[model samples]
Target chain A: MTVTLAIDCMGGDHGPSVTIPAALHFLRADRKARIILVGRTEAIEPHLGTALAEFGERLRVHRASEVVGMDEPPAQAMRSKKDSSMRVAVDLVKSGDAQAAVSAGNTGALMAISRFVLKTLPGIDRPAICSTLPTLRGQTHVLDLGANVDCSPEHLLQFAIMGAMLVAAVEHNERPSVGLLNIGEEEIKGNETVKQAGELLRKSGLNFYGNVEGNDIYKGTVDVVVCDGFVGNVALKTSEGLAQMLATFLREQFSRNWMTKLAAIFAMSALKGFKHKVDSRRYNGASLLGLRGVVVKSHGSADAFAFEQAIWRAAEAARNRLIERITERMERERSAA
Target chain B: MTVTLAIDCMGGDHGPSVTIPAALHFLRADRKARIILVGRTEAIEPHLGTALAEFGERLRVHRASEVVGMDEPPAQAMRSKKDSSMRVAVDLVKSGDAQAAVSAGNTGALMAISRFVLKTLPGIDRPAICSTLPTLRGQTHVLDLGANVDCSPEHLLQFAIMGAMLVAAVEHNERPSVGLLNIGEEEIKGNETVKQAGELLRKSGLNFYGNVEGNDIYKGTVDVVVCDGFVGNVALKTSEGLAQMLATFLREQFSRNWMTKLAAIFAMSALKGFKHKVDSRRYNGASLLGLRGVVVKSHGSADAFAFEQAIWRAAEAARNRLIERITERMERERSAA
Candidate 1:
């Protein structure tokens, strides 16, 4: 099946400069994939160059008059910017012009717009932001990064189902293990909501791995880690902070003096290898799971290479029919109940 | 004033092997500080050696027959282990025989024992675990690390007051700026609890910095970051996981081959410097705030150097009369309300 992704060309910090190149690269690699570049004609055309003639109808451009500001409030963006690049990208997905939407726009606005446009799948109470993080055993998926601050026990259970289905679809795992994110591995650990979520997950028939702590996410103890958006967001940002600090500290150490600089040259390949192993760009895309259509949000400041990765991720999700899988699983769960 | 700290020597992973040596090192550094070693006499005597004679009566060993296991349940330890070293240590602080207590035992049990023996100060609803984390501009204190999972707006306010007083007493930062830990710095971010806590913080007359996100904790955006224990614990553990991943990756990179191993030797000093700067041992002690008597908990697996740092932190808090500061501040706030 051919996977088509609608790209928000006028979004993110770099806008068309990054998005256009990324989309072109993605198209060059995947012969069966198609892209609809949604943005202002003038802005996108300047970067398209010969790509329009090269790919013909496979690389099409759709005009979007408005652009959502990076810092625009979600409510304001949803209410005012009906024709925004982000909104149009989701619209393409909703209208069946594209199978999936990919945007590096304001996360809150993207989530709001996607939820407003596509709505959620049947039996799914809310859509969750699911993303993969580098771990010892490759990668693990975590959900509800910042979409819902106050999640009910049912919401957490829904996240688990969505996250597990996401891993199964994209990673092609039949029965992915899911772990509820908690302060402790003990069942008695965490607040009332988390405890109740743990109980719900235990009987949810989703290959539950009981409770896993924050460290378990990186340890790759389970395929899916589910938590409320508040805790998940804090955990994600905290990991980012530590990674930044380590990177800064390492850079400072390797560039401190002439001797260290010389050592850095000798150790350059090893350092590069280590850097490649933990590159954030490698895991650039986050899936907005439970939506009726697939929507992947890229980091706003992602470069062309990173944005391309997000496009590929969206293509993979689209080709694998992630939305249908989630819908089916939720329906199965509902029928079982 | 001479500060006396009751040490739970028969606790933690290494027990007296780590605790006794750490106490001796601490005593050597601080002439005005005294330590009362509370543990099994036989286990304590083997490590004390000449320290008993060298420090004279300033270093006394108060024997406790039982030891609290690292994995012991909090309620079980509190009920049946009355003579446990952890209990004895807190008992000393409660009786005013020691100004503060230092333990490297089970966190849940330590908190339970301390709360039972020392009790919460007037106007303070519950005790909080406050610890300093390494940041860009030195460090920032965060609470509660794992004490109170479900905190009300009023409880968060009490935590802010107690955390501020602890900083004032130990770090000597009067009117320290406190930031509520939320998903976003915006007023509309986070759950109802955090939103209400933010409101309470803003009007409570403390040096409030509004809301700060997870990365702000490392950016040193504020002097203190306040959050419920559940969120704080997850953030802390998540950081530990990331740090470990980076360290392991770096090691694997440097030891890949003979050529890289040679590079490792050349980069050893620079790497060592970087490691020292972010050493978890330097930020060892977590102060249990809002208790009537100051109680500091060290990491259960802390090395001698790390345990010594915890001792020094306990001494510093005791010397500054942390309990008195918290009591007075709570009393003042109560009268004002």
Candidate 2:
């Protein structure tokens, strides 16, 4: 089936400078894919001028009146910026025009607007944010990144099923293993909620590994890690902070003295390879799972390549029928129960 | 006043192999400090043989009948291993024979036994696990690191108060700044508990910085970050995992080829310095704050140097009268309210 993506081009730190270039790059890469760039007409026109001339009908713009500020709260923005670029992008997905939507706007606003418009899939109580990051082995997906702060044990189990279904559909894994993030690995270890979730997961149809800790996320012991939004958000942000610190140290070390500077020059290629492996930009998209339509969030400060990666993620998820697969899994689990 | 520390010599992965040497190193470093090494006499004797001859009465052993297994649950271990090394070390603190207690045993058991015996200080409901971590600016103390999973706004405020007091006492800061760890930096962001905690912190007498994300931990934007134990634990562990991953990648890169190896040799000293800066062992101790007596939790797999750091932390807290300072602050806040 032909695929289409709606882009909230007026979102993120750089706005049109980043999103328009990213859209052009994605269009160049995927022949069958088309994108509806949603933003103010004046802002979109300048960035997409020559590219739009070349791509013709394949790249088009859907004008929206307002833009959601990065700092605005979700509920207020929802009431005021009803015709915002982020809202229009989600609306395209809600209608039959686009298969998936991509945004680099305010995360809370995006989640709220998407949930309001697209709505949660059948048998799912809430839409969770799932993101994939690089691991030593390959890549691992962690979910409920910041969507639902106070998740019940049942919510965690549902996150597992949804995460597994997404991985199974997107990566073609038959049964992706899911790990319940907790303080300790034993059956009786974590707090009451985690312990109860473990019991529910053991009986769930998905491949459920026992309890995992913060360290296990990077260890790549499982394909998916399930946790409440609060823990997942902290873990994700902490990793981001540590990675930034290490990178800063590396840069400082290389510039310390002439001897180290000279050594850094010689070791440039090796360091380059290592940097590529751990680069956060390489894995930029965070899927808003459990939504009826495919939606991927690009980091607010992501560069062109990173934003393009978000587009690719959204396109792939749509092509693989991720929503249908998740729906089927939910229905199967419910019927069995 | 001289400070004395009680050590659970039979705890940790290596038992006396780690604890006995740590105690000896600590004794050698601080002449005014003394240790009560509690464990099986046989297990303690072999490691302390020649050191006792040189150090004489400075180092002494307090024998215990049983040992707590690393895998044993806290409640089970508490009932069965009443005379265990960990319990007796805490008992030394309770009996006023030692100013503080240090352990590398099962964290849950140590916390349970400490709470049951030493008890919480006045105006504090629960003990929070607080620790100093190396940051880009310097070191920051983060609290409630896996101690209380379901923290209310009131609990977070208490943690903020306890963390501020500890930092003020040990670091001698007049009014140390505290941050409420949140998913976002905005006032309106975060879940209900965090939002409520923010409001409380704003009104509280402490130096309250608004909200900070995970990266702020390493960025050292504030002296202390207050989060629930669940989020704090995940953030701590996730950082550990990422640090491990980065180190592994660096090693792999440096060994890739002879040219890279040659470059690594030249940059060895710079790399070593960087390693020393981010070294987890240097920041090994986690203070169980809000307790009537000082308790420091060392990493389970810590070596002598790491364990010694834990002892140093405990001694410093004891000397500074952390508990008394916390009590005074609590009393002040309560009276004002």
Candidate 3:
């Protein structure tokens, strides 16, 4: 069975410069994998040729006439650019032409288009963007990285269920421990939404790990960390920013004097490996879980390496039957209730 | 004139084990600075022997019979533990026995006790905790870190004003720019609280830089980042955890093999300096601004080094007359309005 991935070729900061080569690389690496390049013909055709010779029949292109601007509002952009590469990519998944859809466009736009085109899974109130972040112990999954900002307790509870399901699907865990992101570890520490969410989660009988603090996220204390989009987004971005800052600061420190500069030479390998561990590219794609169809959003600044990772992530999600597993779990819970 | 800092001997994770020695160190460093240790006589006397002898007349212990527990609620703790060390510390600041008060006790207890004992500055709705963190560019102040979680628009505006004032006071910037933290940079991107706060911030002027994203916090794009306690605490702890995780990962990578171990030895200085730059202990103390008196909270896990830094921070806040400056600024804004 060949895995098909629909790529929104006109997305991301570098656009075709990165995405085009990335798609070609993915097709070249996996002989059983096929890609439908969704973008303007003129831009993607040239880049696809040299790389497509090896996988001649496997690679195909579906020209998307309109491109969504990164600056446009997700709702407005979805309405205006109905035939955008992102929308078309999602549509392919909706139509069952592709196993999964991948886009590196405006996050809001991708979420909006994915939800509109693919629709939500039954028993799912809101779709959440779940991303895996590298942690000290290994990797931890954080949900609602930025799907719904002002989420209610019910929405958060739903996100928790979907997040746990997604993590279990990908990590192959029997039952992943879920944690609610809060200011403190105490049961009564967060805001009203979080407090209510905690109550619902406790009652939900999921493998809930009670409340976990922001510091606990990277400590690998829980398999799944759940929160409303606003706090989760802030935490994700803050982590990214801090990692970048630390890397930059280390470089500047090493470059200060000749002694430190020499140290930098010897430490280059370790530094590079450290960079790889924290690099956003290593975990670039976020799955929009709780949707009927699989839709992954690659980081906006994704390069070839990141895009390839996105393809691998998409393939993994599809192979794991993530949507089906979530549906089944929800159905079992509903029936039991 | 000599600076006097009231040390809460009963505060923090280890209490006097860290605080007493730290105060002695500060007293030794600054001969003109006086220290008043506030706690039970037996609790503090054991920690201060040779150190107090060296300081001679510079150090004095103010006996406070009661102590607030770590798990106690702030309001209940404040109401019950009237003679608590935290309360005594605030009393020192209120009665002008100490120029500033430093504590690492229960944060809520500290805030509540400070507000009750020292009172709020004129025209201030609530007190805010402002702490500095090392950023990519330099360092920036994040205010209301864990003080006012569910803040009103007016409270947020006050936090912004107080944050800017605190930054300007300590950083010595002529006019510090304040950024209202939101989900997006656009004026209309955040929830209702942010929208209303943005309008109030713009109208109030005072060098308001529009809404800033989480990524921008570490970029040091603005002097002061203002948000409600919940969001600010999340961002703060997330950044701290990320830095710690990265540092740990780098250490683990360096210790992986003989070659990496040699590189680690060579890179020790640069790595140490980088760690120092991002160390929470170096900037652990957060000034409780908007209160009539100056109060700083050291980290619960603060060591002697962290406690000393807290003392320094308190001294700086006192020297800058932060409360006076904030009051004057608020008065000026009110008069203009």
Q: lDDT values of the candidates?
A: 0.92, 0.91, 0.87
Top candidate by DockQ: 1
Candidate number that wins on lDDT, 1 or 3: 1
Candidate 1 ranges with C-alpha deviation above 4 Å:
none
- Tell me the lDDT of candidate 2: 0.91
A151-263: candidate 1 lDDT, tens digit per residue: 99999999999999989888999799999999898899999999999988988879999999888899899999999999999999988887887788888998999999998
Assess the local accuracy of residue B17 in candidate 3 as a C-alpha lDDT between 0 and 100.
85
In model 1, state the lDDT of residue B102: 93
Question: Per-residue lDDT for B1-337 in model 2, tens only?
Answer: 6888999998889899999988998898899998889999999999986987877777788999899999888999998888999999999999999999999999999999999999998889999999898888998999999989888998999999999988987899969999999987878778899999999889889999999999899999999999999888889989988889889998999899898898788878778878988989999999999998999999999999999999999999999989988898889888877
Residue-level lDDT of model 2, residues A1-337, one tens digit each, is 5699999999999999999999999899898999999999999998876887888878889999999999888998788888999999999999979999999999999999999999999989999999997777889999989999888898998899889988987899979999999987778767888999998899888888889999999889899999999789889988888888888888888889898898788888778988998988989999999999999999999999999999999999999989999999889888877
lDDT of 3 by residue, A1-337 (tens): 4889999999988888888788887777777889888999998877866665667777888989999888778989889888899999999998999999998899889988888888899988889989998888898999887777789988888888888888777789869999999888888787898999998889885899999888888888999999888888888888777777776888889998999999999998998888777777888889898899888888888889998898888987887888898898788767766
Q: Per-prediction RMSD in angstroms?
A: 1.0, 1.9, 2.1
Candidate with top TM-score is: 1
The full ranking of all candidates by lDDT, starting with the best, is 1, 2, 3
Query: Candidate 1: lDDT of B301?
Result: 93
